[model samples]
Target: MSMDAVTLPDLSGRTAIVTGANSGLGVETTRMLAGMGARVVMAVRDVDKGREAADAVRGETEVRWLDLADLASVRAFAKEWKGDLHLLINNAGVMAIPESRTKDGFETQFGTNHLGHFALTNLLLEHVTGRVVTVSSSLHRRAPGIEFDNVDLVGRYTPYRAYNQSKLANLLFTLELQRRLADAGSPVLAVAAHPGYAATNLQSHSGSRVQRALLAVGNRVFAQNATAGALPTIYAATQDVPGAAYAGPKNMGGQRGAPALAGRSEAAWNSVAAHRLWALSEELTGVTFPLTSSTG
Candidate 1:
């Protein structure tokens, strides 16, 4: 399928929040959603960059501050949100950067990519009228499972391992969240997508210069552009996909192609791990599933 192959329903009157919407896949996703007539809030850490990106977008868009690495920032963003949210795209993330901790003293990659979104989603769950779409990566296959005993990877931390673990956590988070939503009989869905080696700035932050150089070359030679990469996410957000569905490129071993329903590793499907990870995430982030049963 081409990028245009996925026919999005008219999104007029709907509202969406796309974290990291200032650049790359987030910008492309925001453009597609807004262009389709949804009112999109570009939730970015850098408001100036967000404004610059939103200026080029052809539909309704607002730039708001959201730093997913900081729980405080996440809380502020979610607390300020008002009215119904048709989509919440957990799109912001860090790659294989130097081993660091977030403002709240958690592993940077897991903190920003998983726990931050965990807290934000729970904080905003009451206002979400539709679904939550999380962006994971095919690299998640490399991770065996969440490091529940030491999620930060502390002494065992390699940039690649940390990134892979965080991405895997994304899939598991979706799995558990969807189960909770179902158990609560909520209509909102939880799904995941991957960009499949899209050429984005995300790779430039790798702690290893050698890896960065190689990825730069790969981005030019083997990766798709951001627009193509955003397709799976757009599809996951709009289409009537099943809860816990994962979408990615359909060709080249999921490296690059049009979006399609994609498979995940066996570890990603382990409900035991998923549930345990959910418990740990709640303990770490101090956020819990907000709905006991659907209010509607």
Candidate 2:
């Protein structure tokens, strides 16, 4: 379907929180959600930038600080949130970059993309009444599987591989979250979406100047802007999609078209991997899911 802001239903009474709402797909997602009457909270690592971006959005919107690389920040955001949350869009993410560690001492991409969101989701599961939408990437297909032996990759770390692992983890996390919710007889839906080749600051972290320049040209020629790229996320959050469903662009290798159900790598659908990742996430983040009867 050609889902857009005009097609999205009025969300006047609903409340949503979007992580990394300062730029890229996060900006557009927040704009549409807020414009559609949802009380949208822009959770960002930079309060100043988040406020600046929030100014560009209409409807009831607020800015909150949330550093996905920091578990304390996630907990703080959850503690401050008082009312029921209808939507939690896990949109903020870091792409390929130099190997580093988050404040919590995990690999940066894996920490922020998978574990951080995992912790945040479990923390806020009690207040999320409607759904959770996690942003993944088509690059997930490149991942062999979850590396249970060595998550950080240690001496084997590479930019693309680490990113691929994190993206795959995003899908695995979504599938597992939905499975657990269903098993517990909960109504909350867990879905995943990928913004295919979108022109955003997501690439600003790339360490290769040559690659960045080439990508800039490619983005101008082949990539969609954040506005169009955000459709899949908007669709996943608003549509009555089934749990574990994946959404992405419906054309050009999932890059440029209306939002629709998208395919996943064989490894992505592995329930065993999903379960293992879920267990590891719980062990690492120290946050538990199915917080309550009403929110889980």
Top model number, TM-score: 1
The global C-alpha lDDT for each of the candidates, from Candidate 1 onward, is 0.92, 0.91
Regions of model 1 farther than 4 Å from truth: 294-296
Q: Write the per-residue lDDT of candidate 1 for residues 1-296, one digit (tens) a residue.
A: 22456567889999999999999999999999988899999999999999999999999999999999899998899889889999999999999999999999999999999999999999999999899999999999999998889999999999989999999999999999999999889899999999998999999998688899999999999999999899999889877689999999999999788888999999999999999999999999888889996544
Residue pairs with clashing backbones, model 2: none
With candidate 1 superimposed using the best TM-score fit, by how many Å does residue 262's alpha carbon deviate from the native? 0.3
Q: In model 2, what lDDT does residue 88 have?
A: 96
The candidate maximizing lDDT is: 1
Candidate 2 per-residue C-alpha lDDT over 1-296 given as tens digits, one digit per residue, 9 for 90 to 100: 23544367788999999999999999999988887889999999999999999888877899999999999998998888899999999999999999999999999999999999998898888788999999999999999899988898899899889999999999999999998788777789999999888999998889999988988998999999998899899989888789999999999989997889999999999999999999888888898885434333
In candidate 2, stretches whose alpha carbon ends up further than 4 angstroms from where it belongs are 1-6, 291-296
